[model samples]
Target: MVNEAQEYLADPVLGERVAAELRALLRDPNRLPVLVLATLWPVHWQRLTARRDPDAHAQARALLEEGTRIRVPDSFTAADAHVLAAEGSDPRLRRARECAVNGEITQYLAGVPVLLQRYEDATADARALLDAAIDARRLGWGVDLPTEFLADAASGYLTRAEWDEYGEQWPAPALADTDEHRGGFPGPLTRVRPRRRLRQTAPVDRPACRLADAVEQHGRRSRADTFPAETFWTASLAHADAPTLITLAESARIRGLYRTQMQLLATGALSNADAAAELVNPLTIPALGALGEVSRWAASIVPLTDPGPLARFLRTLHSANQKEAIEVVLARGPGRRAELSNRFGVADLVRRLYDWNHYGRFPESVRSAASAELAALLTRHPDGPTDTGDPKSLARFVNMLEAPAAACATATALRPRSQPDPDPSDAEADEAPETAMVLASRLKRLAEAGNDRALIDLLAEKPARRVAVSDPSGVAHLLRELTRIADTYDVDEVRQLSKRESVTLIADRRPLERVDLTDPTGVALLLGWLNRYHGHWTSWPDRFLHRLEHRRDPLYLSLRDQPYRNAEHLVWQWERAMLGRFATRAAEVALTDARGVADLLNTLSPRTFNYCPQPVAQAALARLLERNPAHHVPLVGASIDGSAAEVLIRALRDAGDPEAASHLQQRAFAAGAYPYLRRSEYRDYGLLPDGTWSPVWTWADMVPSY
Candidate 1:
């Protein structure tokens, strides 16, 4: 085919026909060749003019000369029967029209973009005419015009509303150049109306709290139905029935009105279906459902072919809603495959939860929720998970769960609830092992020489084990006893993720640290053991001494006077003192922020280094706070050394707090309020070998400068 084309074109007989056609076109004297020349990029013309071959360059240069020499048609013609009247309007739009009338394609292309500078600023008629030419060009009818004319015209086309109004301006300008068409321009090119959503105004602009107040006040005198429709429709809502509903949706997103919007949707007060139907076109779906209106929002999701928007929208919904939406996809999505490896983001969620792969990409809260759900999916059905490919192999646990609920109650029995504190006299002895550790020791002891009372207690805790399993003492208790010594793992519970499928590694509301068994803490955690000195303390010491211990530089000079060597005892003392001194205030403060208790705990943290340092103290304080004595002393922010304390105290003072004065007084007392509020003070005293005083400074003056 290639050889044939070359041979046929090369024939002199075919060549002459082409040359005749060229001559006819060149002699025609229409501005089309000039128009086509105008559209050619200057760089392209330069390439041709600068060609190496003389004949080719001459031909290109001639075309260039022809374009330049071609007189731009200054006169005008009537593509439209109407008068070419953009008379007193924008000079640019009028100029565009003059070129259009005269069929001056090159001239029109050159001037259109420059002349019609501002579409919005342009007069209505000017805008309409410009839009008409652009549409007609796009529709492949503006033939007499240059192809580039549409490009310039579109730079300043009619406003959206003008597009529908001007429909088809005139018979398409039939151009002389048959090959020229703006085929690259987008089509189905008729313009639609400006979206009512953009133009409409919401009823109110206040935040939720203020709106709630207003709603409360409004409800006091008149019902929501009786509340003025006029109030909601201050704008000329006439012929704006759909827009009015849209306005309401916008208002509802503003804050307090989310429920109001849902109410409207539920009751059909806004005629949601009608409003949606009215704007069913891709151009008019208003933004919605950001305030967790998901299930209802499902019906109105934009039918955009792109799933990205929908996926992102689903993420912003409430967790329950998010799970529901995922379930929706699982239950009704393509083929309704209820298989475990569905595209429900379950695997991703599971991966995120366990820190399996995503690292910390999802927040801990999200991970916690994902974990709960994955656990539920594993445990929900009696048959257990349907797929082996599940990220969590739930099927293996079917045998474990088949046992009665009593079998699962071992964890609760092992860690008995609400035991009394040990006697203070027992501090030095500290010989009593942890109950779990004791259990471990007892099991070993029993295998050697059984004790009946201990066995009875064990049987009481594990009644299902009275009959015994493989182990004579009961396999369940033996297995449960491993948590005391070997660091075996277990699910916290048969967790119900929701009321769908649903972070505590050990137990609900219990702290968890994954056991390595190699490290001391891990070893102690697993064996329910502690080396008595793990945490023992005596009193709250000065901050300076506390800071030394905090830095891991424990000086005997600091610890020598302390009666207790155990850091744990000191933490125990600090808590008793803290609660005793500030119970009332702490309770009040916890209402506002539980971290207030943590803040107080952190204040003593430097001194409590070995027992309850920051991370450890925070956990302990959290557990203590969770127990909620209903009375905790509000922290004396002024007494704590930080700007946060000052800020808190200042806030209370500004709020006219009575205790603010007392707290400030405490701050003063802490800052050495008395001339000599004496405590035993020790200064470093250098001594010689014979115990005689040494010179303060053989090096420098007493109050020495560096």
Candidate 2:
């Protein structure tokens, strides 16, 4: 049988030699010791097949069935049977059953409970595997499968009691439940309900009300609340049959609430005179009227574009019984009828408007309107600049005109009435320069009085001295004037003034050259003025440079030369020092004279070289080499013993002198030379007693060749 089993195991056809030997071993009681080894044979073969083959299910199934069906002794207990049954419970162990039934386990398990238990276990295992797969997927792996297995497991696990408890606590479908509706315990399937559709509704529309209707309604509500009050009287007069809204507005001015009435009228909602009067009456209260109600009334009349009504209304206010009403009409008329330059007595009214306090901060619309009228008057009548006779008004007029018109008006204003055409035969003709000076003096006085127009006026005369002379030392005063005009007047005015003044001052160059550079205060002031008013210098470079060059007093020289002085001065000195050094060097070489070389050398003190040591040495050496190359040899040797040797050697090397290289190496090896030079390339040249060059080994030469 052993031979037969060996043959059978060797046979490629049946391939049951190992199985036959195992059976023979089981049949012999003497070979029962082999059963221990035989018992592990199927396990060993299964493990081997699992390791070697991609699919081991068939092999594992064959091994399991062969081991199970092979008869065992009756000495085995129920525990052993149970252990075997447990082994069969494994899906891997059931591979034989699955293969025998072609993956259908239905015919293998006759007991329903056993089948059900196995199915439950398999379902649970499937769920566990799915859970692991989901976990892997969440960690960015690529596993995907239907959720049916999870649904089956969840349904199978939900007992009646469990379902009741789950329903009581959660009462909602678990996210894991994905099955179709089933008749088991209430799962997600039975609880889900269908959705219902919703109905639609329509939108409503309405008509819009006119602004006039809205204002009338507001006025009616106000009147009802204040019945038996003066507002009722005002409202009644507002609705009276006046020819225009301006008439009603004039009538409302006599009543108490003209301010409120005017506000309503200005809303552009009043369709008739009566409504305007009602609006204007509330604004006439003394407290309300004085609160600048007329300004608002005037603005309200603007959109009406019928200046005739506004002009007539203002005339009525001017003729009103109250003095305050007259004052308001006169003072606020120009701003109100700003577009009507030809209105009766409007210029006088505009002049009166200037008298009102705080004109600068007037409503922008009012100021804009007033500016237009004033600009027109100034344009048409050059002589009638302003009716007010106030210098500020004239200034305001000049400020409003175009440049040419302003210039013409200023010239006309500044010329003395008699001086329009001066008599050449007059005895005072000789005093013309004095007269011009006096005119300049008067113009400056006007400027001081805050009359930029007068200043600009006198400037147009081209006074003998366009620049007003206050104090020669008062540069601060001059700066203040420039800054004042720069800040307050237009740029062209400032520029014209500056140009005329610059020309006037050009004759007396003393002011330009008289800077006290040594006086710290004067220096600081001058520098600040220079920097602040640098724009003024765009036309005066030669004048500025002249002052800088000619002012060389001890104070000026010291300040100019100080290293720790102002940054501008310091920068200027650095440039000057560099130029002076270069110039001295150039003279020393170009003159081909020993005196020039001596002069250049005399300037080379330790202090001079220390401050600008490199450039100073370079310049000196360059001069020496160009003048006389031999003259530099002793100097280079002397420098080699001093602190400037390296600088001197670099300068010579840059001049392409090979002797400089030989001298540098010799000096590097000299006694008490720079210790660091022992490691430098310059150490390779040694000085010979006969004054000849010789090569010497350096530490670099000792390094091994790569």
Report, for every candidate in turn, its global Cα lDDT versus the true structure. Answer: 0.31, 0.35
What would the TM-score be for candidate 1 when compared with the true structure?
0.17
C-alpha TM-score for every candidate: 0.17, 0.15
Please tell me which predicted candidate would have the highest TM-score against the true structure: 1
Q: Which one wins on lDDT?
A: 2
- Number of clashes found in candidate 1: 26
- The digit string of per-residue lDDT tens for model 1 on 65-170 reads 4433223334445543135463346565465665454454334544332233332243454433334343322211211222233323432344467555543541
- Candidate 2 per-residue lDDT, tens place, 584-697, comes to 433233322222233333333223333333565556545555554223322211212433334444444555565854464344333113322322444223223222333553
Q: What total of clashing residue pairs does each candidate reach?
A: 26, 19
Model 1, position 402: C-alpha lDDT score: 29
How does candidate 2 fare on TM-score?
A: 0.15
Q: Name model 1 segments beyond 4 Å from true.
A: 1-113, 117-123, 129-294, 299-310, 318-329, 334-706
